[model samples]
Target: MPVSPKIYHGNSTPSPDAELAALIDAHPKPSSLSEYSYGTAGFRYEASLLPCVFVRMGIFAALRSASLGGEEVGAMITASHNAEPDNGMKLADSHGGMLDAAWEEHAVSLANAPDSQHALALIHTLLSQHTSTGDGGNSSKKKLPKMVVHIGRDTRSHSLPLAALVIRASRAMGATVIDHGEVTTPQLHHFVMHANGHMLPSIIPQRCNESGYCEIMAMSYAALLRTGSVGGKGNVGKQRLHSTSTLVIDGACGIGALKINQFQHIFEKLRAEGCTVGLPTLHTVNFPGDGPLNDKCGAEYVQKQQLPPRLYTPSSKGAVSKRYMTSFDGDADRIVFHFEDEAGKFHLLDGDKIAVLVSSFIQDELRCIDPEGKAVKCGVVQTAYANGSSTLYLKNVVKTNVVIAKTGVKFVHAAAHHHFDVGVYFEANGHGTVLFGPKFYDFISAADAKLRGTSRHNRANIALRRLRVLPALVNQSVGDAMSDMMLVDAILFLRGWDLSTWSKLYSDMPSKQAKVKVADRSIITTNENETAAVAPAALQIALQAAMDDMISQESSGNGPKPRCFVRPSGTEDAVRVYAEANTQKGADTLAYEAMMLIYKLCGGVGAPPQPLITNRL
Candidate 1:
């Protein structure tokens, strides 16, 4: 008989306390125990199997603490927004970012070492030598080492247990652990800096007088406030501002609700001071009674929801009720927002919107601050899946340099570190990360110092200046919904512009993506050659010929040629089809037509079936 599945709430599956105790005692041996193989995010593993991974991670944390002047290390084990089947682990640095590539390579090597005994010995030696002498290899100052590691998880069923495993391991390693419980990825990152003995600056704006000049002054004051200072502080003198922001948060019924609640609290406090805060009213549909809220109801499933009433018209007057709706996956790391027009139509604001908002805000505000200033030129780094419109807008409209990297957060993180000041990369499925340049940090610090020196009356003016610059500072160096929300809010609020107006600023080209799940996981792509396995080279040539024929039939040869990238899905047993064109109809037509041609090449199996075509922005 097929066993019924169990369910749990508040970031974990329902494992009976007795069952959990039994499972802990059984110690179901993992396929293998390895060292912390930290990646872009950190050490990740299947949650059910994470206890084993945590054992390895504990040793690694001890090693990292010893080597880095006795600083504590941490682990993150939620899959961000991946499906339930997938889970991962990541090792966070003392600074809250993931370990650098060199360190990650070292960790991976340790994990893949031939002998576990040898790996443990190496870890032990590293820890002993570093911790014993307070010498981080070359440092001579006896650093009053205060190492704090903040750990949290999103709403994945495995998150709680996985987080518990991490907490247990960190404590076992003798590191003081602050269990943030369920929090957004960005909030976790923010806590890292905020809790690390750093006093962030806050902005306080004076009430807007009838002269509209007060509003301008208030806006400027808000702008001047340092990004990190606003939320951590208890109060910002009363101008009584309600967020005036209405967000339809598709919480995915995951741990995102925790983060969303934090945002609500922030807005609520602002509302108490007098700001109009609106929340995305949730209306559940197609939810299963027995199953946990882990399905497509949140951001991933938002494309399928009924268009909210506020988005119906583009030109409807009286504040058109600008609404920003976002959904996070099973874990709250990934985010995708929806903007409604006056016509009650929904539009997706994916990584492209992120790029657009970040780029436009930086360009407009920085120019206002100093027209001829040669501050570091901000750039947007994205994956190939970025919408054609985004690339064009960043280049022509925003005039920011853009770099296209491969998919995955690691690649984005690496590119952000290497190339740009503000790297914005998001997968078509809505995973994203942002990188902020060091110079941006310095600028905000200087502005904050100026504010600190001013008197109370001038404090509001200082706050205004900081507010103008807050968008650049508060945003996380990683892709996070909370950070993205704050970024979007800062941009639109400062400009008093609505989302539809901003989205219309640039025309987006049409793009379509298709997923094909294969029955056999062994049918993997080797060396990027899609036709390597087919017996006859002629068959490969034939497939290419078909794609070429389609491309040749294009009507307008003006823009870039039709682009398609076929690859195996990273997280699923399937193949993915991505096609982009100048027009949506054209993109869809070409995609479907190409699928047919490819299907014919594959012995007419019809390219492995898939679920409905999810219209992800």
Candidate 2:
């Protein structure tokens, strides 16, 4: 076994052991809660076991801010789409993204410390590494500003108490705290990014506050509508968009309900002044007190079940056939759209669908503005979970570069940012956003200057105008459900398409997903992008056999090939298996085959997984 490397402070002041120890002692970890890991959503667990984790994460955020020379960091208290009793936190870096990967290891170390003194030791080690002592090149010797941390939470009954613990621990580290009470996760991300100087004043031109978020989103949306509306000045504006004036939002009975209400009010105020045309009338359901958060409603439920939320049955007022409907996860960071057919069937328009729609629109607009598709690089980033049909559509139909990343949104975002000038990324579960790189900003600004000097009714000028305001409507720091909803709506409106029309852009292969419990989840691993199993030596071989057998048994016809993969979940103690094929029956059989293989080969713990379907495919 290798020994740990020695830690050095490099002449910094001694650690604040007394304060750290006191803080740690005050928030004691439960005896039964022995191990903790910083999973995709941070240190999540039953609310009762999270107090200690919250306090430690609070201190971690404070130190993280200090490491960035006093730039503000954020800690958002939410377990997006999890049940109400479960809660967690996600740290935002100064630039308004997830915490850096290097620091995630340190967070795990801090959370799993055995005692207060042990926690102090870990804190001291991290503090030394993070806290800078000397100026790099400046001779002026200006002092570093006080450390600051921004905090926000969802509507869970215990979220406020958890927030208090964070505030307490952060204060103990001499960090200033900005408590943004009762806000959506994306709103908090917006606040932290703006507070830390991500203000694109030329593009957004608004104050750095909650109202500023509303103003920027509203103004940009109105600009898109006014530029792309039907019967307007340009040839492009004559499309029959806005078939309906109403949009029903399922807010998951969480903070998104409150924020959507606020956004609707602001949007209507602008519409009344004739600033926008064909903006929808908002109808919000699953508001707080109307139901328990995420209890059979939300993006996760809708996307996974491929059905309407329990509270949003066909008879519900918002369930009008063919009308557009969307669902927000508990904290509103992820969103998925669906509609009830005239025959009362539920259909989901998931992230893959959204990615295709958005990327196609951007590519179309860029073609009009640049004629040659060379000025801007556009691409879509997805995960192994993306439907094979979507990957084909993206590469063949949309004709843009498509790549896969690991399952987390951060990994997908990083891949998108690295690959394209105009990168659009989304998880199959609907957590994602459009990232505009420096090249995109430069191209659009130059195009705007050129177009404004020419005819305003021209197609190039119209597309340029819409592209100019597009960035303002997105939350650049992270995925914001509200922002993405606006993006989908704008694309649908400009194209004059309903959910049915949009869904017709491409067909999805029938797919199935299942989770298998094992004695040790760590024993099951996968290659990068999680497309194939690598560990448990026999796992991949067995899965491949299943896939080959599946293919040979099917009729050779003009259909997509069957595909499947198994990977350990980053956030749970189980392994997830996903499969898709041209037919729903084929998908169910392949998925069930793979599930049984893992259950037997990977030390399955609980009862074996059930049959995926009752009838033969």
Runs of candidate 2 with Cα error greater than 4 angstroms are: 1-17, 133-145, 198-201, 230-243, 312-322, 555-559, 614-617
* lDDT (Cα, tens digit) per residue for candidate 2, span 172-218: 67677888788888888888888876445467564456778777887
**What is the Cα-based lDDT of residue 189 in candidate 2?**
86
The 10 consecutive residues of candidate 2 with the worst lDDT sum are 1-10
Q: Each model's TM-score?
A: 0.70, 0.92
lDDT of 2 at 480: 92
**Over all chains combined, what TM-score does candidate 2 have?**
0.92
lDDT of each: 0.51, 0.81
Residue 114 displacement in candidate 1 (angstroms): 8.6
Residue-level lDDT tens digits of model 1 in 1-617: 11111111111224222322333343434555433445446655556656655555544554565566645345555666455665776666655566656666656655554444445445444544645544442122332233445666665666777776655544444455666665556545544533432223232222111122113222332333223233323223222223334555555656665444544444344446754322222222212122345454555555323233222212331233335556665555566666656665677666677677766766655554445636555777777777767777778878878877766676766777688655566665566655566665565566556557555344343343543445333434345665455556555554445566566776566677775555443343423223122433343454455446556776546555666555555554555666776666656665665555344443333344433342432
Model 1 regions more than 4 Å off = 1-46, 84-86, 109-119, 125-148, 194-245, 274-291, 303-323, 340-344, 422-434, 441-473, 515-548, 568-575, 583-617
